[model samples]
Target: MATGWAGDNAVQDQIDATVEDAVKRARSQLNQGPSLTHCEECAAPIPTARRQAVPGVRLCVGCQEVRDQQAAFSGYNRRGSKDSQLR
Candidate 1:
């Protein structure tokens, strides 16, 4: 039930595409090798608890928090302009 000019499966297709993109992003972030003992950004000692809790943990709590904050501010434009959509 697409509400726009697109076909019935348009909305479902968009949803599926979004989910696939999220999965790909998550998989890319997954650590493929050993976890670092120190924070890569600040060179601070990464706690054993954190390392154990999150396998492949790269940054410490503080650095990770800052990184998360930066990520939060990076907005995404899901809706493209009419001209772009027409293409």
Candidate 2:
């Protein structure tokens, strides 16, 4: 059932789009070749366990944590409406 002005499949379409976007984003993050032995950011040695776990890991644990924190703060509300934008 359509809940809004779009159509009967609008909600399902949105859901499918969201899932597709997430899958694309995740696939983009995968390493293409060999894992780096050192952290690219801090030049620290990446642990063997991490390299084995992540496959093509770049940054060490500490640098990766910092990068993750920075990313967390940079996110935006992608679903914001035009009405909300005006406010």
Candidate 3:
């Protein structure tokens, strides 16, 4: 039941933290105002289905997919501490 230096339930804790951060980020974006009917980056029109499906989608399906993929690949040092940073 102990995970030593990693701490107990370290993996689960990291996952929960990531999910919570993501949810908070998404919610903040929603509070910014209504979603536009078109992608800001591109002139492409945002489909009605997408706007209704996602509360505050700023990008179209294609752009959203790319952003999601990039986010998933980005890494964060969850185990890093202030002491570690100093070193």
Best by TM-score: 2
Better of 1 and 3 by TM-score: 1
lDDT of 3 by residue, 15-39 (tens): 9999999999977766255777998
Give per-model TM-scores.
Answer: 0.65, 0.69, 0.53
Residue 5 miss distance in model 2 (angstroms):
7.9
Ranking by lDDT: 1, 2, 3
Report the Cα lDDT for candidate 2: 0.85
lDDT of 1: 0.87
The true-versus-predicted C-alpha distance at residue 46 of model 1, in Å, is 1.1
Q: What stretches of model 1 exceed 4 Å from their correct place? A: 1-8, 75-87
State the TM-score for model 2: 0.69
The model with the greater TM-score, 1 or 2, is 2
Misplaced by over 4 Å in model 3 are: 1-26, 29-31, 76-87
1-87, model 2: which lDDT tens digit per residue? Answer: 755477779799999999999999989987777889988898989889989999778889999898889878844655579876555
Cα deviation of 38, candidate 1, in Å: 1.5
In the range 1-87, model 1's lDDT, one tens digit per residue, is 655588879899999999999999999988766679999999999989999888889999999899889888845555678775555
Name the best candidate (by lDDT): 1
Ten contiguous residues with the weakest lDDT in model 3? 71-80
